[model samples]
Target chain A: MAYTIELFMVSVGVGLISGALINISIGYKFHNKGGLIGGLIVGLLMAIL
Target chain B: MIEVFGLNLLGLIGLILFFGVLIASLRGWIPQDILPVQSALMLTAFILIILAFILGKPIGLKDIQMNIYLHPITALIAGFLVAGALEAAGAFKAAINILEKLSKTTLGLPGTVVILVNIPTIFAMPCGRILAAALIPAAILFGYILAREHKQPALASIVVFGFIVNAAASCGPSPLGGIGMVGEGMAGGLGVAGVQLGSFVNAQQIAIMMITAVTMLSMSLVFKITPDELLIASEEKAEEKREKKEGVSREGYISFFFFFIGIAIVFITQPPIPIQTILIFFVVVIMLVAKISVKDLIGGVILHPIMAMISGFIIAGALVAIGSFDVMIQILNVLAQTPLGYIGVAVLIANIPTILPMPCGRIIAMALMPGILLFGLRMTEIGLPEIATPILLTAFIVNAAASCGPSPLGGIGGIGEGNLGTAIGSSGRPQQVGIMIGTGIAAVIISFFGFI
Candidate 1:
């Protein structure tokens, strides 16, 4: 259970970071803020699943 | 005869295409902005993959599948995220404030300048970009102050570009996702018994300090950059206002405290916790204390270095798949047989990254690490001293780490140039000379005191 929780936490952190990075790298480059929302959604979903 | 000069036709073509496109694009024989070097490298990898399929080489598949090294990539991402968190918390602003106060002490401005200029190497970060982005404003402010006080405008360029060179090279000694770790990891994998993973870090840091000093000296003596001539009034005013308004907040000191404490803990304890996990734990703590948002962290991430590293890995995978490294090794070995001998050839090979500098040192470091390793070991086999292996690796890694400083195409020096409003390649010559001397210093240090 402890290991599982640790994994989940790290996964969430990774998800958050990856989402932010993609948002800025691709979204900001193209002047689209929507990418942040979409990325966060996908990131959270990936983390949860 | 399917072979040309000891290499198969396929290997020869792969080698030619790999170096040809990379050098041509980087050197501006082909325009880089239109077809960026990373894009060109990815295309080269794709072409090699296609050729491997046509040639029916099964070995290529194994290499491609297994050799796309990801340890450094994962580490880099974690490190960058940590850097972003630290940036969002204004830890760097606090640092600049501390240095400013130090300048008023018995140390005075010149002593503070040396310390401030060497901060990146002093506290080596995973990506030099982290410190470079955070502290460049400080460099500029001090640089302008020095220039105005001395009535020599070139001092502005000197201090700024000197700090830029230091930031660029400091990554070699960084314990995080530093370029030096690439070599250390390679050495560990080679089962060179008793080789500690970070034995080269100290030597690299010592050499980098000399490199930064040499770079400043070179710029002062040889390069005549008139930043006063290039300064934009609006930008200058905005920068001055920004510097003046930033008072070190409580959160800034708090975040800075946690950041370094975390690194110190990790270094001393060698904890069982995953470094990523530990870093994340601190990030969360810092976020709460510093009142920074995810949005702020997002703004801190610069994708250029990350993307450049990945592109290099891809090309390395493709070349490995095509057996190009074997052909490269054979060529180096043959060259070692000449009047140049193993020592001469080894020195040349170690310094090649500086000779043909890329925009990101990791690109060359990753792509050519295997070939460098094999060639270094071969030199030892041919009666070069056993100690020469680590020395060669350290010299090569430092050279690769610092090469980006002089690179014309989107290298770290571009950041300093843009801020100074100078031409893109103006600092290239001085920076290169510094890197060359630094590489020599690294080799000498390792030869004298190295244990791993």
Candidate 2:
């Protein structure tokens, strides 16, 4: 059960990181570098947590 | 004296503003194509920030940032990109061709429609519109082939609409990617005690499969469609002509290979390396094989509702920051205390996508699921049966996500309208209502059975 919970959390984490990458990628396309930077910072913070 | 409906002045103000935005967005008064759901959510976030300031409870960027990461925005992003890559690589078209050929075989049109409608369940990525873009065309083409033979265009339309409903409902149970991942992510985020996200995903898939099967069966009966009518083959010469015109490419086969490998990885390992990583790896490999540039891949990713989704997350975060969800929880808790109220809440949540009707209805559901799940958790905390919470919440999630098919404003309905070349308001409305009612009935049944 603990392993299962960990797996779910990891899956959710992967989703968050993937979403952040998408945001950053789109931000890069649109020249919104600030949004990308913000997203990366948030993502890094989320990962550490 | 200023309080209305048990809300203080400030709470009343916040509630009105929230509903005002919600109604305006749903009623198409906001012009989402220009402002978009993302922009709307940002604006709402700004408003919440201001409200927080005025209320002397200023929400810091850190607070909003943390909440932003709460939902499965990344899963949705990955799901869209993976689906888009598959579409770009002609993976879906290849599947359609194979299914089309099968329809030409002994299994017939009914068998073809069954496979076509349920294809997304296996492919299960987040973007229904992309799936619709692939499948709806083939479905309509199949319908036309039937009409050409049987001279009953209505049969074609019924089969097409039935396929649309099935595909739409399949989104909830799609274990590989799609809204199912989003649902699971949200469910996990809600801290629903003892519920495993993977198992929850599998259970939802089973529940959705049951719902879709029943709904499709009922639709066939209503349309008086028999297996014989669906099986009536097109002329041999015509079949040969179609085969010649629409042969699958070598790249398409490769794409199919990559797609299946990804699915196999998911089923076999079940989060061995994280599903998004698997999806990203496949997307990269597909891009290389298909000779699609990084720019094109980014373009495909950008075409999704990422902006709308981000906006949804921001808006949800803002709502939380402003204590709106707390207010909602209180109302839900009150409602859940009674059997009638519990049923009403269940029905209301299931019908939200239809009642709200937005292209981002799934995202909206994604944002709201946490609150609903939290409510379910509250119910459990108050001694409601342990099994009842997840089952009711799953029913709510499935219905809200699947109900999008019938809304003219919904992504699937838009695709159907475009294909049928009829305004959704007129031609697609009946089908929309039919699917909504069908899924609603399915939701009610699932709730009653607690099948999960």
Best by TM-score: 1
Q: Which residue pairs in candidate 1 collide?
A: none
In candidate 2, list every pair of residues with a backbone clash.
Answer: A19-B74, B125-B178, B126-B178
lDDT at B316 for candidate 2?
66
Task: Encode model 1's per-residue lDDT on B80-163: one tens digit a residue.
Answer: 777888888888988988877876775455545666666787667776777987898878877777766777778778778878
In terms of lDDT, the best-performing candidate is 1
lDDT of 1 at B55: 77
* TM-score of decoy 2: 0.76
Model 2 clash count equals: 3
lDDT of 2 by residue, A1-49 (tens): 1223433433333323333332222112222333233323322222221
Identify the CAPRI category of the predicted complex in candidate 1. Answer: incorrect
